[model samples]
Target: MDLIQRFLFEDLDVRGALVQLGPVWRQIQRNRDYPPAVRSLLGEMAAVTAIIAGNLKTPGRITFQLSGHGAVSLLVIDCSETLNLRGFAKSEGPIVGNSISELLGDGRLLLSLDVEGMQQPYQSYVPLEGETIAAVFEHYLQQSEQAPAALFLAADGDNAAGLFLQKLPAADEKDADGWRRVHGLAQTVTPGELLSLDASVLLQRLFHEETLRVFEPKPVRHDYPPDREKISATLRALGREEIESLLADHGEVVVSDDLSNHEYRFSADEARALFDTPPPNLH
Candidate 1:
């Protein structure tokens, strides 16, 4: 497993995190052909979400999903507390987007926080500025919420990386000398640096003089939703009528086959989840 580390400053009491994705980058590419602009956005989103997961406290998944009208219809970054991330994008052919506002037009971004143990999830929708993801996030902090957050992200073919900084409420507002100094230092982080440096090295390079405390690394893992058995049970839940209708309409949905059986069927897992009782656990 590749390393991702989180650190903090003892004297400054400021928290920081670092994450690098090389192998995971390939997994994302397996789904479809994504244009350069779309790929870059997803890359940045993945990196930022990883950092966000590291900083926030949660056992479940946090999703940064963007959907709107434009060349790029959708972009999703699903990140868990452990750092297992996988996602895909929907776009309209080859489209070059310089900013979120230009790409999404009149658009909005949805930040969904889903916990497996919880019944109700948390979500916030911030209007898209047609600017870069970085700019949109800045607006999200100032408008949607009160916390002032900054994000710097970059991506290459094999790796995606980001640095996120948010100022916490300090006891002394005007007297807080470290705040401005830290922010200025953070501003020195270039896109190339974010994509290149590892966590420890990056922090040391950025804040060499500050007293920093490094935290124990959290193991990151991934989960693939819904297995084949679950898929069949879900297909059966369409009351058989709908399933038959679909079969008639679209013929067989072939997943795979052996020498003897065709093993093809319609998929209705999503519909089942929305309408019918879930199948018994096969575990």
Candidate 2:
């Protein structure tokens, strides 16, 4: 299971978080042959997205995306409130010398909140100059969530982990001290601790004196994409013309009553069935 935990320091009025990912990290890399640089970016972004998703107030999905003129034009990550997340990026150019900024170009990092067509999602575009995923998100929180936040994100070839601390909104001016204390302690977290230690141990190590109320570790599962009806809408949105064009570009296209085809083509209907039913055990 993906190890994601949330903790709070009730007296200090600050919140802390930790997300340790490994098996899932390997899974993300399995389907795509991403270069070292791109994989690194994905690892960092994945951890950040997972941690932020865990803290989101909604139970639907949150997406962190980057698009524009860049080597990698897109980074799409879907974060479920259940902490089930899956993400991938599109490489617009060669993988050579690709940094996250170089990949995203002069793009804006758009953090979109999709609540399953419930409420209007929250969106904030931060300039891609964050250089690091952590920095960009810190800026986003200040501008969007109206909170000062810090993130410690690290990734190896096969594992990704993240830690987060944020100042809770308060009515008094004394919160500065609490924020400083937490922030200073947070600075001590090494990459090893972030990726290896349990959330409770990490919190205690960071804020030994502060009274921290730890919450139960929440279970995070992986969610497949939309269901059949939704996928039909998606496919229908493409219009019969587009579908025909796709078939013409190659061969014939068939819309089956049931989603079972023995080919490597885009079968939206079949793909949609994954969500209508439960996903096979990721384990």
- Highest-TM-score candidate: 1
Clashing pairs in 2: none
lDDT (Cα, tens digit) per residue for candidate 2, span 24-128: 777666557776777777788888888888877766678888676777777777777777767776775577664556666678888778787666887867686
lDDT score, residue 63, model 2?
84
Model 1 ranges off by over 4 Å: 1-3, 142-145, 171-175, 254-283
Query: Highest lDDT, which number?
Result: 2
lDDT of 1 by residue, 170-267 (tens): 61353367666776888899877877777777889998988777887665544454356655665665576776566566665444322111244544
lDDT, candidate 1, at 266: 47
Question: lDDT of all the models against the reference?
Answer: 0.68, 0.71
TM-score of model 2 relative to the true fold?
0.77
C-alpha RMSD (angstroms) for model 1: 5.9
